[model samples]
Target: MRITSKVLITLLIVVAITACFSLITHLSNESQPVGDEIPARILISQTPLSTPLFVAKKLGLFKLHGIDITLIPCNGGVECMSMMTHGKAQYATISESVAMFNSFRDTDFSIISTFVTSDDDLKLLALPRRGFTSIRDLKGKSIGVIKSSASEFYLDSLLLASGMKPTDIERVYLKPDKLIQMMKIGKVDAISSWEPWGYRAQATMDVVNLGFQGMYTLSFNLATMNRKDETSHERSKRILAALQQAITWIQDHPEKAKAIVSDTLNIENNQLDWMWRDYVFRLSMTNVLLANLQLQARWALEHNLVEGKQPDLRSILDRSALQAMQDEVVGQ
Candidate 1:
């Protein structure tokens, strides 16, 4: 009887141990995406403002987070957002205004985290040779702006604040880089844009800021396709964590960050020096952000930039990934 009881006890213990092992295996598989098996492709805007992600990639922070990422470099956030919107990429860094405009289509993308913020980033660069010194002076004069991007919204705000209607000036829709050329040749009297294009205008035509987006900050955010799966949630957290970690590295090592950006973007260190301090990189989402997005959407709607209904500002924000980051930091 004692021998039989021992054999039965050993069998029960073995079965319990096998079940525990199986449970752990299942969890390990479900908790995170198999990085070796599947890689996440993200779209990165090839701008100095995207220095953190670049630093992260250079330092292998993404890999440290167990994520395999393939970055597709784009000229601007709008371009980045376009690729992500079409499912060509899983993630993107898009400007707040561009993201707001794209949200009208209800794409798979959602704003997961804000990358950078600046009060005087977006400015109306007026050619000094044309006697355009102030925002109000640009009235009734031709103003070159990039349509359907932040440039468009910023121009509208400037016009509104000056109590001038859009029709009061010749709204010459042009690409940001082209705006500088247009001003140089006297095609437009003023141009509303964001750097480094704004800086380009200043250098070439000696353009001075007639106005700044002080009240409406020029912000950039990181976004990804919205997915409800646990694996997706974990992956998003991992990406943010990697980026957050990189931001610390950037703040700690500005010269190293600048060198990486200069090599990657082909920007001269001298050129970067002027606009470097304008940017503040961080991961944040606040009520002010929400209000800015909503206001931007309304501006797009009123300006006929988009048709039909507006998107829910709250719906576009998925902070679970950010919350996960907070938990991890506190845990550490």
Candidate 2:
């Protein structure tokens, strides 16, 4: 075919437009960022038990996983859930059973992973003035707890094992630090608390020993998230990955972990050592943990903390990401 000047001009213009469009597309693609810097806000309670998370964050583990983690410190797990409900944080490290039972009682709040499993670190503290030697002697007396917090379950379990029902004692709800003050003022007979508070009560109040739930049952420690849309799924996985690495690093480096915890939580070196020795920092979601969680769920039901309905354990916990991590390590 013979090409006319008009046809040649038109072809040239079309080709120019196509080239320009391609260039624009390429420029646009180049302008957009490639790195994903999704910020992960984590809710933590101020205590030795929850200090490792802060240690991990401060040490840049979360950043290693491509997450910008913001640690939101709260009083306890119950307050942490409030932060989760109000969209204050993406993920939270709290008591697995406490969060689950509360969710069962109210909304269906679910936790993703169980980081710290053992509850052997918890202490049943009695003020020196109370003259309480054991759980039996503490019957019919007031016991301070965080109300719907993890310590509440600990208190309940302690009472149950001691042949005392919940109705046998007057339950008092107070913050960790306040519990120590209340006990000092003779407001309550005993208090069930974790780490620093128990440690403080022993030091400040010179409290008498009741008993400890040592290696008793694996209570949920951290890695709890609300059941949201898929928008947070990948983010959740990444956050867990960071946390898993942090826990593993702590396990591998106990001296470093102890120093970090002591500095972060403002506890003495010996106290930090006690916490490290008492609690297992293993982040595995093992069968033993699952069994204990189920038992906790059942206990919630029995104690009317879950009402008539029970939380579907499978739906509440997503262990795929955790399982994958385990598999990857084992495969390596």
Best by lDDT: 1
Candidate 1: RMSD to truth: 9.1
Per-residue CA lDDT of model 2 for 130-197, tens digit only, reads 56778888778998887666677777877777778889888898877788888788898888777677
Candidate that scores best on TM-score: 1
lDDT of 2 at 281: 65
Give the whole-model CA lDDT for all candidates, comma-separated. 0.81, 0.71
